[model samples]
Target chain A: MVKVHFTSHLRHVAPSDPVEAAGATVADVLTDVFARHPAVRGYVLDDQDRIRLHIAVFVDGTHVRKDILAAPVTPASEVYVLQALSGG
Target chain B: MAERLYVSTRKGLLVYARDAKTWKHHATHFLGAPVSIVLPSADNQTVFCALNLGHFGAKLHRSTDGGVTWTELEPPKYPKVETSDAAEKEKAPAVAQLWSMAWAGPDKPGALWAGTTPGLFYSKDLGATWELNEGLWNMPERARWFGGGTIDPALHAICVDPRNSNRVAVAVSCGGVTVTEDGGKTWRVAGKGLRAEFMPPDQQFDPVIQDVHMLAQSPSHPQMWWVQHHNGIFVCTDDLQSWDEITTAPISHFGFPVAVHPKDGNTAWFVPAKKDEHRYPVDGNMVVNRTRDGGKTFETLRRGLPQGQCFDLVYRHGLAVDETGDHLAMGSTTGGLWTSPNGGDDWMLLTAHLAPIYAVRFA
Candidate 1:
């Protein structure tokens, strides 16, 4: 099981507290999280179902730089979703 | 004259309501979001706002109770195309911006037209659902279309014929003008006389590749149309079969917004700015060029306008004329808003500060 957490910015639109989900990869964990909060999917991914250009995902405190969705995640990993600081 | 106004800006949607003779800031919506377009339905009861959120992509909302309450609505989306892989799929299209929108003729209620970064969309249920006009998208000539001011090639102009809802005209910044007589069923390239000086000599006069900044049609004379092109200004009274360039602009011919008179075809106004890379007021003088006798003559009206060391750039949707054609409102990139009660002859500064106005409309 992995603990998924969303930043405060996204919390305004979806859940704020962390939730535990079972998955083997970051995408799998997110897929499980989205299943519960469907509206969060659009805030995290673009129309092409890809992680947004200005969003970052971290698994077990390690930044998933490339092939983000397919990045491997341990059973007891901490996944953090946050917006990048570049838009302004 | 209109008593209320809607201003879409970089930070949010600003509403100005008329209190007696003064316009006051009435409300704000979607604070901190980049509102690209704000449109009111034909009856002025339903208002729609398009937002280009930096991280969340494009979104839309509509208000039925005079903007006091809103309902989230699905924006136009592109059909997925088959791609080999994620890297190669970068070329796949998406709606970068909802550039422009228009209500269909009064006869066709609940019908709305929208121009996006790469395609035209039609909504039959007041934006509840949208369908792309594949006829225009599938045209082979669309290959020539490229990005102009926007990051992606955009269709920014939509003019539905006043007499017949079936006849419509749309202009793409870098893809010339196209018209359809049977609504969105079919389309044909128009603007024969438009010139694209940026293209090669042989293709300079090609109608399929003109970068039209904006297109406007006179409400009283439906056949009369005006275009603010990349190279200059043009007018076509023959329903866009051909265009005649206007060479008598007192200021630089380059501009973005063009508002035609409601009761007279020959009366129109444009906010001229430096062309191309430098898009500010000409010689630091902000003025609105008014032409009452068509393009043959123009009056450089600058009364009450800023001159000398000014840097205001009015975008395509920044200028609007009311139903009577005597009231006009103009906003600028430098956060300036001005209004004219008696046409463009004089102006009154509404506000010196607002979030870099993107579009303004009379309500």
Candidate 2:
């Protein structure tokens, strides 16, 4: 099981917090989450299924490279999908 | 018949309904999101609002209940390109935001065309899926169509022939205008009368390099088109094949938006603004430059609009005309909203303050 949390900006689309899912990799977990909440898919990724420029995903408190979205995950992993802040 | 106005600003959407002769602000939606484009369907039953979500990326919301509720739809995006280099892969073209949108025609129902930063995209199933027009993308001349308004050259205007769904014309901010008679299969330059003063003297009249600001066409006249370029104004009557320069005395020839009268092809309106260096209205006095005889003579319309230290400059896609051609509305960067119910004769300011306005559409 993995714990996934969406940022506050997406609260209108996703209100409940810290949903639990079963997956072996980040891709698996995201696929499961999207299956439950499909509206969040286009908001976070382009039509080519690539993550947007300003969006960032963290696994177990560590930033994962966008090119490697298939990173392995465990039941204890905490996934945070948030809008990265780059500038003031 | 009734009239509704959709005002999309930097902050949200403002809908105004006209009851009899009095216009009242109806409702507001998408409170804090950046709404760039508001496209009403041909039947005027639905409205599509393109929202630029920071972390969530670009998105589209459909309102079938007249701004009461909305449903999410697939947004426009470029396809994935296979590359080995990590840095090269990171720099691939993607849809930063939706700059403008238009329906293909009344004949081709549910066909939507969207213009973004990278290029233009077409959706057949009403935005369920989108495909980028590689005909314009794979052009060898695209490399020279650089950006002048922002960091990246953007596709800003789309003009679809009301009679023929296949014939289309699109305008890019700094890439001039291109037309295709067979839909999106092939395109050619249509900027014969346009000029780019920023370029060298010899390259001023070259191909594929004019900063076209706005593109408009009257629904009743299917053969005529009007364009607002950064340097001057142009009109095309040959199905976007060639353009003729059309600006006379008292007309600045420089503005952000160009709107045609709904029923008359020769009638059009523009909001005058100082071109470069300072982008405000002429001498801080806001005036609408209008022409009834194509572009032969221009007249200034300013009855209730602000003058003197009023730095309200209209943005591209900020002006719109209702289906009756008797109503028109515009929004300014300084958050001023105004409308003329008597065909540019008299004006009424709806609100003195709103966010920087992006688009105004009649529903």
Candidate 3:
């Protein structure tokens, strides 16, 4: 099981604590997280089911490449989803 | 005159109400969000705001009980493009902004029309769900639409005929004007006689590529419409079939917004600014040009406006006229707001420090 966490901004949309979900890849982990907290899907992913351009998703402290939902994740890894620090 | 005014700004949505003859700030919503446009429902009971969130994407909010509270609605979304070409699939479009919206005429209280960048959307249940107007989206000429001042070409002005709800016309920034008679099922491009100086001489009058800044239709005369084009001012009397350029303004004709009188199609107002590269008020003086004889002559009104080194720029949706046509309100890119009680003859600076105003509408 991997632990998934969100930034404060995402928490405002769907309040949550760090959650543990089982997945071999980041895509599966997000799918697992979205199944439980449906409202966060639109904020994290766009209409094309890809990570939003300004949203940063990190797995086990390593920055995931854009649209790279297939990156492998360990059972004990921690994934963090945060908004990019841009815009005024 | 409208008792309430709504101003959509770069930072938030500000509401103002008239008390006895003076306007005062009433409320503010989405304090830190970029509100691109605000429109009240046909009854003026429900107000809708479109926000361009920097990170989360475009969002829509509704307030039925005035501005006290708001409920987020499902914003319109572009369908996922199905293509095998990686280049085409990677460049799939999204709703970059909600440029304009209108109530789906008087009879269809449950329906609303939304104009967004790249396409138009129709909502049947007060914005709970939206369906893209496929007819306008699939038009082959859309490939020639390019961004005017925005990253993507935007469908900014929507005019629904007051007499018939099914007949609607929408103005795209660089896609000219498209009209539909059978609701959203079918559409035709109809911007004729509009000249584009930016294009080559041979393609200057192409209807599909004319850049229309804003479009306004006289409420009493449904067939009379006014357009603030990138080149200059144009008026259409034979519905949307053709337009006639008006070049009699005393001041520079380059501007964004055009407000026509509700009761008289012959009266209209526009804020003139320097052309193309320089967008500030001409000669560092802010002025409004009013035409009462169907654009044959113009009166430069600046009695209450700044005559010194003012650099205010009114956007395409910044100037609005109330139902009575006697009251007018305009907001500027320099965070200035002004109101005129007797047309454009005189103006009063309501507030000079709000935010960069994107649109202003009376409620």
Candidate 4:
């Protein structure tokens, strides 16, 4: 069971508790989360089904920059979805 | 059932009151040229405006008892030095144009902070006196890069942590975000996730210029912040230590402003424009996008806004929300003054004639 922490703003639509998903890849975990929380899907995925430009995902403390959300995940691993920063 | 909207334009300040559902314009030549920023104090008893006075230099004006009359606040004078090289020191810091201003204490009425083109200035005696926060001006990085150049190391936005008055965050354009944890004695650059990729090839060594135009902190979560940059929109959870890109809008890269809903952390808004050379609107058509889920997605709101050939540039300091709980989004375009009451779902033309608006605030 991997633990994914949603930021405060996302907590509105996300599960009240950290979600538990059994998956070998990041994509599988997200798929499970989306199945439970449909409203969050549009927030993270664009029309092309690509990870939205504004959404950033991280495993542990490092950023995962890839098109495929199928990055490796372990039962004890942690995931985080970050809201983007902008302006000058 | 109309609303009265006050707008500052190039010609001067104008009052547009709603009558029978139509906006009527009343112009006042309170300032010469276009106004850059308008700040209404917390009590709504004072309206302070920054006006671009051409070669005469930028001036700050104040009006008490609403906008009935105005008085120009004399620019604060720093002690002059008499030396053998008087010529060099005599030259004023190239006409410091005020970019942004904020009133700090709700309990202490007169506490105010103002950010200008040259540096940051503060006042405890309302607008009667001023003192420059030299700690920000004396930044070594400012002198090495932005100094002597057109870019001012001045603060663009100063946010006093509602939870802790001493905890302050100031957005310094071209200087990144500076935070003071122990009051204003010490400050540090909090630009980790942000990059300044727009810099010249030679200056590529510098972190991408995270020219933060606006910074909004969630009242519920002080660590969470939303920053509007020339490059893109960013969100930070660790007091700006790290950031995530939450702007996936069609024109995400080229917006000048960002406004977070005062009550809802999940609800925030921004204006979008084409990137690169096509940044400004080609015609009169423009759009205001609001992100109900913290900028993960944006829906364009264009009910009453112009659609055809319109040039509407919603500047950095333009759009803002009032304490009344109604979202008041204002913009300065080649066209005139526009306001949106129901978030950004629909907008109304408040005025038809005025100079390009540089800034707008409820107070």
- Specify the highest-DockQ model's number: 3
**All candidates: TM-score of chain A:** 0.93, 0.89, 0.91, 0.86
Per-residue lDDT of model 1, residues B298-328, tens digit only: 9999999999999999999999998988889
Contacts from the true interface found in each model, as a fraction, amount to: 0.39, 0.72, 0.50, 0.00
How much is B205 displaced in model 3, in angstroms?
0.5
**Docking verdict class for candidate 3:** medium
Residue B281 error, candidate 1, Å: 0.7
lDDT of each: 0.88, 0.83, 0.89, 0.67
Can you write out model 3's per-residue Cα lDDT over A13-87, one digit (the tens) per residue?
Answer: 765789888889889998998898877887887777777888888998889875568888999999998888985
The runs of at least 3 residues in candidate 3 whose Cα sits more than 4 Å from the true structure, single-residue gaps closed, are B82-85
Query: Top lDDT: which candidate number?
Result: 3
Against the true two-chain complex, what DockQ does each candidate achieve?
A: 0.61, 0.55, 0.69, 0.01
Q: Clash pairs of candidate 3? A: none
Candidate 1 - chain A - TM: 0.93
**What lDDT score is found at residue B285 in candidate 1?**
98
Order of the predicted models by TM-score, top scorer first: 3, 1, 2, 4
Per-model tally of clashing residue pairs: 0, 0, 0, 35
Q: Of 2 and 4, which scores higher on TM-score?
A: 2
Off by over 4 Å in 1: none
Measured by TM-score, the strongest candidate is 3
Rank order by DockQ, top first?
Answer: 3, 1, 2, 4
| Model 1 chain B lowest lDDT segment of ten | B84-93
